[model samples]
Target: MQIVNENNLGEFLERKALKCKEAIKQNASLLNRFLNLCLVFDECKDDLDNAHILECSSFKELFLKKAKEEDGYFKITQDIKALDFMQLNFLVNQCANFLKSQGLKANDKVASFLQNSLEFVILYFACFKSGIIFVPVNACYKEDELAYIYEKTKFNYIVAEDELLAYVKCDVLKLAKSSFLKSILKHKKDFIMPKINPLDLAMILFTSGTTAKPKGCKITHYNLLFAGYFTLHQIGLRQNEVFLSSMPNWHIDLQATALMPSLRANACFVLLKRFSARRFWQQIVFYEANISEVVPKMIELIKLQNKFAREKKHKLRFLLYFLNMSNEKYLEFKKRFKVDLFTSYGLSESIVGCIGDNYYEKMSYPAIGKVFFAYEVIVANIKENKLIPLKANELGTICIKGRLGYELFAGYYEDELNTKNSFIDGYFISNDIGYFDENALFYFFSRNKDLIKINGENISSLEIENLLSSHKKINNASVICISDALACDKIIAFLELKEYPYKEEVNILQKNKELKQIEKELITLNLRLAKFKQVSEFIFLNHLPRNYLGKVRKNVLGEIYGRN
Candidate 1:
């Protein structure tokens, strides 16, 4: 054979490499399908064999074991009682046994009506061990709202605080917050732990009913545990840190984002009875809290407190922040408080925080941040019975897909038709409009229903609400379009003033002066804004009706406006 030259060998190698690259490109789609199929098959094969599921599938043993491994503890500030890992486990066991003796069985619902206390938390975790479905009722619910929840869940088995006993019609296990541990101490007996399937429904967190009738989200043990796992591994949660929160135990933010994640990381959660703007920061310093979560309203209230001097001694790394704030306020708040804010986004159905942004400088306008963990996020347009993927900066509905029962909630409880309608092409339709940037950072604009077309131009009511709330006189604000189709989607801003006493109790002259001055400011603001963005009218209210989460119920406001 003739000896091959270097140039000839190089040409042959290049030809082979070209063929290999072409083959890879041609099979790329097929390869992706195969990999996805593998994941599905792996999921199917998973049983009690999977570590996380194994631990959660049977709660008592693995739970106690994990607690021991982590050496975690929880401090309740209400009574100043601290429970170590073993004490907590023992209390949960007692609580679980107590529930069992009350004729509750697997899948039976237990509604808990209490504030953020150890009892509320113990009952929640105890449900996991006992295989009972836990429902944390919003602390803010009055008798009428409680009646509605009772009608929906048909749950007669309720654990209520002594004060809240009058609000519900249930087989009551009433509690006094100070004597919670003593109340449970009387029931000391070991009971057989029920077999828990990881896929079994664990909790039903209700959506904010101010917007509409609350829908109960069916969350599974796997969903909750995976949320903890996601935060621990993907979000870089450190072990054994102290987490402080006054968030109501009823909230998904308190449970999935704070409680469960802290559980997995072996961190201590310092329980505060309620949020106090005056005492909250000092308490943070007292507890040396590493992390805390807050809504925009909390931040706004704290900013209003306007406490002088930067609090330099606190161990707070950052606020696990939500909703929106102006860029000016965001910077000032950080400078004033001496603590950073980590922007994040999630919902009741999304489990834990699925999107977050920690970098400060990039937040010229806060982004919902890039989708995290194994979630499949997309901004999409559905038209003509087709789902089309949207590009960067193109406004569209946000959609997410994940393994149901693990990453996402199973479905809306007992509402099969609505659940079916909620998902399109295997993706959960969020019904929220936003856009993704070139870097895939999502920016929330408004709820799809909250978006209004004024003079043939689309406007986000939230943008108006934010601007109005930024005003010194305003306490809270919500913007809604007039119901009159003839009025061509005229914007109306409903505002709650800072010093709201009873409407009848307010000094007439002082109120009128404040209104006239605000009206003049609105006129100047109107001239400065886009023609279509200007508010047609603004109404002052004693209080903007809100749910437990402090979200303004625009639908309710729309109804109120219609009547007025």
Candidate 2:
């Protein structure tokens, strides 16, 4: 798989649209017009600065133009018209006014516990439009987890669904909790809007707790807008482009890829309640969505769909995947879907979409693409407390800096110590290790903490897990290093099988044999690993515990594997 260059990208987009039986000739014309307008806007920012033009209105006009020209195109699931964007802005103003009338002051943290709905968008924008800081809690979090975040963030007000209100237990907190129910009853009429600046905190997204407790990353309006604008440019998304979002909006992946990017481009966004493999293709066909952001797991699930099996093809033009798809699978997906595939690497702390690679690039180098606009990448050695720029193809820890780097979250909410520790001097240390190849493509190896040091040799748990995952019989796998009395920490592979024949018969011995077979597979995998990094033990589990983001909970696995 070669890195897709600009020429390759053009060809790929053309081929994708052709497969959909839609002529790109018309789309290209519309795209040119939209792109030209964007260029004009970019060149003449002074005139637009005071226009007060609603973002949604711009999106609707473009959407209608495309639909009208394309014959009632299937482009969006949301009923987004020019009026909707204006109405949304108006609603946000109203909501902000309502909050202020309730006596909430500027810089007040307004927590929202809701799914990806119109209301979520309203509340988010309302917070930003006003001076309030929005704290979006993951709806999938358990009551206890939510409570931890609430306490950590110390939000003064919370807009929550009626169902989620039950999870609020006042007895657990040392400080008194302000009830939204009581607030509405007490002062319903006093709410007004608060003035805000671009620097004002817009959101606080918690990192998925895969290795440790989740930490909140506080992002500002400037950070989001800057990142959003650059991302839209990088992806070449134009007004009238129908963007489909399937991932949970709370995650930074969705925020950077879909929500913010769409708004920045004034593009139509189709938000789904949840990802459904069955309805994925149907929705694409129905909406005529031109672009979508997907995770690797979702792609695998979609490949399993019966509709996909029978239909033989799809109309998708472009797919931006967050996870690293293997070169083999990447090529196969391109051939099968007839769409351009783009992969990128990013984290919540960065606030910006760091690096990305589109599928049309002929160079199949494993790098996560080049540094985003105004961002610079550096490979450094942490131990010496020194900066070491590795030559192309030399593996090292990756660090980022520059103007775009400043757009990274201000800090963790209420945890100044952790925030201070996250950065080294000026450059923010991402804690992930990777290296750029000769083509300047970045390849992520594993998190700094995820590396297991056995007898001074560092081992990547992710690398081992990736290998085991390639096996057809293994449904999921997690690799962890556990301490041994004599040998120090030794690698242990935990596996979940796709099929266990003995489960029906309720035969423990047969199940053990199946587990042993998996262990044998791990033994073979051990040969490729360093001597000290080889798996010394194997554990067969019905399932591996995962966080809300579906990443394997390595901390929990450490405890389980250690206990056994």
How do the residues 313-337 of candidate 1 rate in per-residue lDDT, one tens digit apiece? 7778777777666777778778888
In angstroms, give how far residue 46 of model 2 lies from its true place.
48
Q: Top lDDT: which candidate number?
A: 1
Candidate 2 regions exceeding 4 Å error are: 1-83, 171-193, 209-211, 308-315, 358-366, 403-406, 449-564
Candidate 1 lDDT for residue 277: 70
After TM-score superposition, the amount by which residue 428's alpha carbon in candidate 2 deviates from its true location, in angstroms, is 1.3
Instruction: Give the per-residue lDDT of model 2 (tens digit) for 1-564.
Output: 111221211122223323323333445554443332210000112233212222222333434454232111222212321212333444455556666675666677777777665556656766665667777876655565677777777777766666767766533321112343233233332234445555567678877422335678878666776666667877878776677776766777677667767766666667765666666665565445678877655666666666444233444556776645567766766666667666677777777567886434543334567776666778777766667667877778778774422456788878787777766756778777888877677887766556664432335576567667777787877888764422345778777677744242211123467567766776776675435445677677666777689877878887775565
TM-score winner: 1
Per-model clash counts, in order, read 0, 24
Q: Could you tell me every candidate's TM-score relative to the true structure?
A: 0.67, 0.64
lDDT of each: 0.64, 0.59
